[model samples]
Target: MFGSQPNGLSTDNKMLSFQMASDKVKGILQLKKYLEQFGYLNYKNSKNRTHENDDDFDESLESAIKTYQLNFHVNSTGVLDKKTLSKMAMPRCGVADIVNGTNCMRSGKKNHHHRHGSGSPFHTVSHYTFIPGNPRWPASQTHLTYSFLPRTRSDAINPVDKAFQTWQGNTHFRFTRVQDSSNSNIKIGFGRGDHGDGRRNAFDGPGGTIAHAFPPPDGRFHYDADEQWAVGATPNSFDLETVALHEIGHLLGLEHSEVEGYHVSLHLYWSH
Candidate 1:
């Protein structure tokens, strides 16, 4: 979304301007909504106390932009720059990186995390975090049963299987596939739009929100069926296994980290 102005913002000094604004009124508002949806903007703290057409670029909005920039390693200019917008448009997990005013992507120290390195004592300085309460399955429940919903794509079988295997290799969690849905602990499925979970977790077509999953005990994993999904990392198609592994981390009581793109290794920070 770009505005008619040279800097992609409105020339009218009535509202805050940015290069990503297509139409000063409509575009900027949509950007705020985007930020809000992914757990960025918190309207509760602001004096305006609204999520609508009020476009002032308030403190909360600027803070949200900075947090997003920090999570993605972009310049935390607090302004809607080209790099920020480009990243915002990319397809990502529907789960909010910031949950309940706590930036889940960046809450703890990277040095305090527990990880396994191949050669050195530490390979990555990546930070890891958990759900709000750190709810986890009992230590005895490490062997979990999983099954695919009937509506899930048939081709997802192998990729999902491999994803589970990868997790088993890295962590103590072991996943076993089952045919009977009633006897499974975790259920994986593909859905479109508001597929009965709720409006907050709805899938937006192909490129915006790709997939979402619940944290431990609530083991439902969903992928947006509208996306162009492929098994391995193929051209132009989203990798189902890669996403599955990330979602599986949620199922195992893990929140995504800032360094997710570079470090997908199992951190095993579970407190259970």
Candidate 2:
């Protein structure tokens, strides 16, 4: 959600003043990928649930806790609060390696405008294709057109390029970077403003929100101007590669993770 207002340093000062709890770190660590899938913390009760009945296994215990909370219509806080602790089938230790990197920034908290709701239904398989070579070079791929925007620095250029490359390497998609031409299928532009496939404005929030890709066939992507991108040694502070990986997942017909409901259970139990 990048189109929201750019409040600048006053917003940063306000954010810096707030303190987050240690528990949040553990929650983040445990739920990182889950959050990426579902986009938020929303846990509800499970119906037609069966207990694993294995007291010895930690996962079984967790499932039991989930069942207990669901049946009772209480929030499955997941944390070992006083009420949950006694009912928790197996006790687990808190994670030590919590809160290592930057604080996770919310999408619309500031004036940043990019907002995501449930996306279109996912295809059984992704349709995008990938073309080889560095995207910065004109000879790379067929669908892409690349250009250096003077407003943005070279540092920004390199990381954003890396992010796109990383996505191509990891997924089965056909894409290529080309020189500026209106005929190109996908175009990459660098600047402070918004760009991408969705109707939502692309550029929003602080630097950490990084870059996003357009849905495929026209898989355009862009990077934010505010960030200080590090190419080689530090692996770039914001991990542009990871963000691109996620966005490319979007471009390839995947939607934000849906809540686990009867539909999901049916998919899990019946579908391949």
Candidate 3:
């Protein structure tokens, strides 16, 4: 995606030049798209702006870049610098940071009211304010079953088990590995490219997206087989346990938190 630069932008310039030229750059466009998911960029703001290419850079895009930089603790430069690009290049979860269109969790009927006050009806609120949708595994159902498909390596088994253990230790839910894949509630596996998950968000080969998992009732967790999966964090080897731990949270209906000053999602602490 990094081919043609935006007029005056160069590696030496150390930033993506914008505003002066209306020409589009692919890498900049990709950054814009990714930043939009985190609510930094607005699609509506750029809809009417005319550009020479699809991946156009503009004032709104610059503002969004600045916002992202500020949020992530990067230098608050309005241009796409090397540091910013590096951070954006890191492998990450396929699931979105925000869920259900709100920062906090939601529950209960949409129109049902018990006549408490002037508050909105149909809202079954959560005791915990941080968790979005208050969505979590049923507290009563403490035990859950899972299975590793044949594609997942034997070496990866122990790490996966350890990852599950970490989750169980943190939360009330327990996970048991079962041999029967069909009967298992959560299915763990390694797949390359499109592994037939029925969802359009398939594994993007090796380095891009490491893994993804479905929420709650559909606890289907899959990792990119192409990635260097390992127990400990090493060069070029992404930590299997870390990713699995995050994915397990998803299986339990936890969404990624947008709150700053954390390396990962704040939902990871929901059990506490």
Candidate 4:
């Protein structure tokens, strides 16, 4: 299951890394539970067990665990090792690592961003890429409008604005807030459960996800109201601005950075 680390780390920290050969049954069970919460090992896909009845570390669980490791940049050992367990315990956004394939709009065009390296993918640093089609807002329209929907906490507004500022500082896109205006291009809000994005990726309450934003043209950004979101980093609380900055990247047609290793090549694909 889980193994104890040297230097006297707490028992809680050692709970999931229990060695499989040693068969720490309880620790292995805990590992299964953690993976399930993140949508890695679910009932339908696992061959031997469902989340409710899983006990043995089966192949299905192993594959999902490896995927989790790769997505988080952990060594893809496919075992419930200490580092993997420790990372699982960290509080992070609830956005699914593997988003639904149909949930995107593509233009099939490429952008000519500068390339940084050449040859080896492992040695090359990965930069952000857009969703397949490279969908983006109109570049000619420099000023994009935004506003918080009603029920957005007053204190949350400043951090959210600052998140936009982070984007504005780097990109040509400029965001301005509007009040009582139905025509704003970007709508920001906090929602619990399904806020009607017409997608399966709904918020999963407090801990699983922090926030998610739609890609350009959709312009719907949502933070899970159930989470302990803070303007700045706080113990046990998510930095609202940091999460907002990542989501806004989505708003600007960027997807999760997934290039493994290093390469000096830039590609952009989208349609107007």
Clash totals in order? 3, 18, 5, 25
Q: Mark the regions of model 1 whose C-alpha exceeds 4 Å error after superposition.
A: 1-24, 51-56, 109-127, 260-272
Cα misplacement distance, residue 25 of candidate 2 (Å): 24
lDDT of 4: 0.59
Q: After superposition, how far is residue 195 of candidate 3 from its true place, in Å?
A: 2.6
Q: What are the C-alpha RMSDs, in order, of all predicted structures?
A: 6.5, 17.3, 9.7, 8.6
Q: Which lDDT values do the candidates have, in the order given?
A: 0.70, 0.34, 0.60, 0.59
> For residue 59, what is the lDDT in candidate 4?
64
Maximum-TM-score candidate: 1
Quote model 2's TM-score: 0.37
lDDT of candidate 3 over 1-272, digit per residue (tens):
11111211223332345434354665565566566554455555365355313576777777766766764668887767776665555566666543444532222221221222233211232122323555556777779999988767887788789878876754568889999999998999888777887544667665556678887778789888877776775656777766777677778876654334433322232322
- Candidate 3: worst-modelled 10 consecutive residues by lDDT: 1-10
lDDT of 2 by residue, 1-272 (tens): 11212222122222222122222222222322222222222222323123112112133234433444442334664333443322221211111101122111111111212222333222233322121111232333434444443354545556556655754544344455555545566555454544433333444445323455444455455656555445543532444443444454444433222222311101110111
- The true-versus-predicted C-alpha distance at residue 65 of model 3, in Å, is 3.0
What TM-score, over all chains together, does every model reach? 0.81, 0.37, 0.70, 0.65
The best candidate in terms of lDDT? 1
Model 1, 182-217: lDDT tens digits are 779999999999998999888877667778889879
Report the number of backbone clashes for model 2.
Answer: 18
